[model samples]
Target: MGKAASALDYRELARRRLPHFLFEYVDGGSYGEVTLRRNIADLEAVALRQRVLNNVSEIDLSTELFGQRIRLPVGLGPIGLAGLTARRGEVQAARAAEAAGVPFCLSTVSACPLAEVAAGVTKPFWFQLYMIRDRVFMRDLMQTARGLDCSALIFTVDMPVPGSRYRDQRSGLAGAPGVLGDMRRVWQALKRPSWAWDVGIHGRPHQLGNAVPVLGNDSGLNDYFAWMSSNFDPTVTWKDLDFIRSEWNGPLIIKGILDPEDAHDAARLGADGIIVSNHGGRQLDGVQSTAVALGPIAEAVGDQLTVMADGGVRSGLDVVRLLALGAKTVLLGRAWAYALGSDGQRGVAHLLQLIEAEMRVAMALTGTTRIADLDRSKLVSAEAGANNRAAALA
Candidate 1:
């Protein structure tokens, strides 16, 4: 692809490189994608307060999360089947994240197994867990994560059942099963010869790595999806946190928290942190955008638990916006995924450089050199904007 200066540029490159099904899987959201659109729109609307006279010489973006001193307040959040983005994609992304001095969270539905990821990177990454019905399997998975020296456990709790994503159906990722479905995806793959040669041909045994033990070694994507559909425990409640805590002694982060009440509940349940997300607008169609939901949720549990957020974060400017709104750290989803698909480990490294550079400009212009100095003070107040509008109208 051409020069990729921003996450959006990488997204375009990814679209050109990947097939229809793969690109749509990474890009599209659930139902009509109302919440998905809202995520980007609301984040873009966040106004930063720019100031001049403060002598901003050096800027530092370093921060600590779950006891790890990361170079930036950004982490590569878990994305399933990320291995499909490139050859051993999750491993590539993890290596890039390590080089960037950021945490990488591996999904339960990942294409690369936990052991493989551990083998690929010297530093331990975080792992995301879904509420599965099988307790035996759950405990085993937790044990496996611990054995791999994972630094933290992120338990995602928003998806009781999978949301209705129309794009997946249209792209033959879901609804169409068996040989017909396989053929449909293969046809799309054939069109993207670059991806086919790289991920399809070279990247052999494209199966969900973690699920292999349960779903059997011969299972395909459809089988994995089908198994996940039946296995996800809809009856999951706060009591499930007890089970998680019992199995894990590391920093426990509850992902998919969007409501203040739920954030309070997570704090009460003794979660180390909470990721204020709506599952990237993949689970619900009309929920509040994370940008709109983050402030109140952070207010509710910021002291009791670390407040992190993810959704519609495409640029370092967007990262600054969320931090100003109250997020201590921001996890990137599609930004790194697109970069991975566009090139691979090198692409993700470039993306992090772009983010860090953009953040420097933002921090310097906002008269803040430290991440700790970023707060609501660096943001344009809604009340002030409204009053300015009113005075102009009068």
Candidate 2:
């Protein structure tokens, strides 16, 4: 609505614009949200080694990923029900990403189906897949992605069982079952007249698009939730990855790798890349933040696999920090979602613009000219710096 200078500003706008439940769903994390807070805190604590008098007239933020050269080393990661943020929200976000020359990944539980999104954008977007219980459905989904000419297949492996998000329960998105819950959500929607008019009424048929075949044409959010509850197979193991690798011919990236062991396993299993993420702190409550987990994982498998990281990446500064921590590229989750919720395509485009601008300034100040040159050397360890200062004072 207003000029959003930062991702947090966009988040505030989204909080004001969208219904309470929808905003909470996009913003809140699982359990006590301990990991969620750490994701941001750890990133913010990273101190950059700023250098002066270095020729930074030519700063390049461009990088190549899976054979595609992007303007920035950042991508719009998959967020389920993203379309609810705006009318044909996924389509808008995809268009924005294409314009920005970055990847926009579509979630399997997206509000719009693959065909719909494909029809909207000229370039093929990435697709994120969740391991559903039905083999037939999973195989067909892979085939569908192939048919749509998807650039990459992101196999999200961390969500064998959905995490317990208390925010969803409090916001009437979960916990309250049946008509009572539905009515509560409806009442919240009615209060946000702008959102109600834009996304609620005009954005007709608020159902999970990709899941329609299995969920039936009449299925809505509640049915989608029930389907997820019953369908997410908790018994899934790394061996199941063989099935996915067999089906997907494109660049296959394993998302949600927080451990070096898992990164090694992904590389051994023939993955093209691995995203060092914790599902935006949505899956586990007390695990290490992506910023904290990325360095070791990158050292473990950076040569064997393309190392990407995501979680608490709110600005271009954070992007630079992750790159210095060993992320070849970084993914933006809540950042883009908040912008999308605030003003749809324009908000996303503006946010990307802001990120690029911030990255340039950060790189220039740090005396880094190229994205490839950004590594641990460009950062001053906050802990070590503090200890050094304490010793000097003592």
Per-candidate local distance difference test: 0.94, 0.94
lDDT of 1 by residue, 105-149 (tens): 999999999999999999999999999999998899999999999
Q: How many backbone clashes does candidate 2 have?
A: 0
Candidate 1 worst ten-residue window by lDDT: 216-225
lDDT of 2: 0.94
Candidate 2 lDDT trough over 10 residues, lowest sum:
216-225
Error of 1 at 265 (Å): 0.9
Q: Per-residue alpha-carbon lDDT of model 2 for 312-356, expressed as tens digits?
A: 999999999999999999999999999999999999999999999
| C-alpha lDDT of residue 326 in model 2 | 98
Alpha-carbon runs more than 4 Å astray in model 1: none
Task: Kindly report which residue stretches of model 2 are placed more than 4 angstroms away from their true locations once superposed.
Answer: none
Candidate 1 achieves a global lDDT of 0.94
